[model samples]
Target: MAVIPVAIAGAPYEVRIEAGLLARAGEHCRPFLRKNRVAIVTDENVAAEWQAPVTASFDAVGIASDWLILPPGESTKGWEQLARVVDWLLALEVERKDNIVALGGGVIGDLTGFAASMVKRGCGFIQIPTTLLAQVDSSVGGKTAINTPAGKNLVGAFHQPSLVLADPLALDTLPLRDTRAGYAEVVKYGLIDDAPFFEWCEANGAKLLAGDSAARETAIAKSVAAKARIVAADEKETAGIRALLNLGHTFGHALEAETGFSDRLLHGEGVALGMVLAARFSARQGLMSGQDAGRIVAHMEAVGLPSSLKALGLDCSGRRLSDHMLHDKKMDAGTLPFLLLRGIGETFLAKDVDLNEVAAFLDEELRG
Candidate 1:
């Protein structure tokens, strides 16, 4: 097992990644399971394949577990679904000291963590992220949130988990599309700050996707560690240091909004395409070389990820897409901040950007 510590300002946590870690979640969580009643929140898809092993692990540790299964998709991260989860926790009579275990992907982790944060003022929660996307990105950071009709993650909180148990073995059951989509986030870690890691991905990512255990472990550990360092420096996103972590999120979230946050475009898939766009646009602005942007797109395509909006089958013009970004949370005083790159592994937030120019550039990409 590879353990990475996520050292936030006041709330330091750890993420344990390993093959077959799901079967040992009880043992891993034993230190934090102070209460008898544990709430396991998962979506139907994950519950069908992974619930038994997790439940058995808890049972072996002599803990009583109750589950709340949600529908599988980004749609589950909404007011109604959040309320349902909170109500279920209430029905289970979970106390503030008891734990809520998030047992699915980013949706489950975000919703469950938000629910745990709200109930009884603040409750303890553990993240058992079953998807590669969550394992590397969403599951480590405390940025728990649900999407609103207006935009993605419009409603949420900073509720850090007590612990995160990432079982890479669970990823074996994930669809290839999902696996490829998750790789977008793994690549984001390198793009944000680690040039060597970015180069490593350019070489080893294909092997990682091919089920090479060594490559998978290294990718997960490095990605988690990169996020851990950022969260430690800026836990609440008050400092722009953490905002750099949103390398592709602003554009990606806008794309997600344009799709109505539906399955038509998975969050990771949007980020994959968004990162490519971010690099290309940065190069267009003379912030980076166009050749670097081409390299990024080439790597993404090699991994079977969507490197362009055209690949997503979205027909909207770039002006329409820019309109969606207006609702992004990164907007300050009507000016949206973008994490543009100087080159690979070097991204900085550009606050004085012109949305009209962005729209025109996006229009070019859409038409190209």
Candidate 2:
């Protein structure tokens, strides 16, 4: 097992990565099991594959647990589901000290963490992220949120998990498409600040996606370590240091909103294409060399992830897509900051971005 410790000021935590880690989750979480019981929240799809092992782990350790499984999809991250989760936690009579186990993907972790944040003022929770996207990205950050009509993740909080167990074994059950989607995030860490890692990804990403254990473990560990260092530096994103993590999210979330947040474009897929957009847009603005932008797109295409907006076959116009971007959560003082890259490993927030120019760029992309 590889342990990466996240050093947030108020709530430090550890993200553990290993094979078959799900079966020993209770062992890792024994120290934080405050009330001798845990309340688990997951999605229906994960319930069949992961819920049993997790519950059995707790049972073996003499820690009791109850579960509430919600429907699995992007649509489930909204007001209705949030209300249901909170009510169920109330029914479970979860106390402030008890840990709420989020036993699924990003959606489950976000919802469960948000619920724990609100219930009884604030309760502790553990993140047992099953998907690659969740493990490398969402599972570590304290960013918990539910999608709102206004935009994705517009309603949420920064409630860090007490512990995060990223079982690469859990990814064995993921669909190939989901696996590819998750790879976008793993690539993101490299694009943010690690050129050598991006070079390593160019070499080994195929093997990692092919279910090579060593490759997967190395990628997850590096991604988590990068994230932990950044979180420790800027926990709440009050400083712009942590904003680099949003390398692909701004454009990605806009794509998701345009697609109605449906299966047509998974969050990771949107991000994959979004990263391409960010890279190309930077090149367009003369911030980066066109060669670098082409290389980024080539890497994503080679990995079977989306690399262009034109190929996504959306019904919305560029102006319509821009309207969606206007609702992104990263808006600051009425000006949306765009995470643009100057090179493969150099990402910086451009606060003076012109949305009109962004609309025009989307128009060109849509025209293609």
Candidate 3:
């Protein structure tokens, strides 16, 4: 097992990565729970595969489990589901000190963490992220949120999980397409500030996705560690340091919004394509060489992830997509900061971005 600690100012936690961590979740989560009974919230799809073993694990440690299995999808991350989770926890009489468990992917973690943020003025929650996307990025950052009519993750909190248990074995159960999408996020850490890690990914990403356990564990540990260092320095994104983690997210969110946040475009898929665009956009602005940008595109295409905008076949103008970004959570003071690359592993927030120019550039991308 690899232990990565997130040292936030007031809420430090550890992310434990290993094989079969799901089967031993109760043991790892034991230290955080305050009672014999724990509340677990998972999506119906995850419940079908992991419910029995996780439940048995808790039972082995003399802890009783109560589960609230919700429908599976990005649509579930909204007001209705949030209300349902909170009411169920309230009915269970969860206190601020008691820890609840969020099992499954980003959707479950975001929804359950937001619900925990409200229960009894803020209860603790554990993230047992089952998907590669959640394991590598969403589960570690302490940034939990739900989507509103306005945009993705527009409404949420900075409530960190009490603990995160990531099992690479979990990925074995994930669909290959989902696994490939999740690889986008793993590639992000390399793009943010670790060129060598990016190189490592370039060499080993295929093997990792091919069910190499060692490769999966190593990648997860490294990604978690990179995020831990950044989160420790900028726990709430108040400083510009943590914003680097959004390397592909700005354009990616716009793509996701255009796709209706559906299976048509997974978050990681949008991000993969977004990073390609960011690289190309950076090159277009003379911040990086076109060769470097093309390298990003080559990598994405090689991995079978989306790397082009025109291929999505959306029926909207670039202005329409950029308009979606207006509702982005990163918007501030009527300006939206973009995560542009100076080069691979060299991302900086450009606060003076012109959305109109963005629209026009996106128009060019759409035409291609």
- Leading candidate by lDDT: 3
Candidate 2: minimum summed lDDT over ten consecutive residues — where? 313-322
lDDT of 2: 0.91
Residues 1-368, candidate 3: write the lDDT tens digits. Answer: 79899998788889989899999999988888889999999999999999999999999999999999999999999999999999999999999899999999999999999999999899999999999999999999888899987889989999999899999999998999999989999999999999999999999999988999989988999999999999999998989999989888888998888888899999999999989989998899999889889888988988899988999898899999899889888888888899998898998999988888889999999999
Clashing pairs in 1: none
Candidate 1 all-Cα RMSD:
1.0
Query: What is the lDDT for 136 in model 2?
Result: 97
Off by over 4 Å in 3: none
Which pairs in model 2 have colliding backbones? Answer: none
Candidate 1 vs candidate 3: which has greater lDDT? 3
**For each candidate, what is the lDDT?**
0.89, 0.91, 0.92
Clashes of each: 0, 0, 0
Worst 10 residues of 1 by lDDT: 306-315
TM-score of 1: 0.98
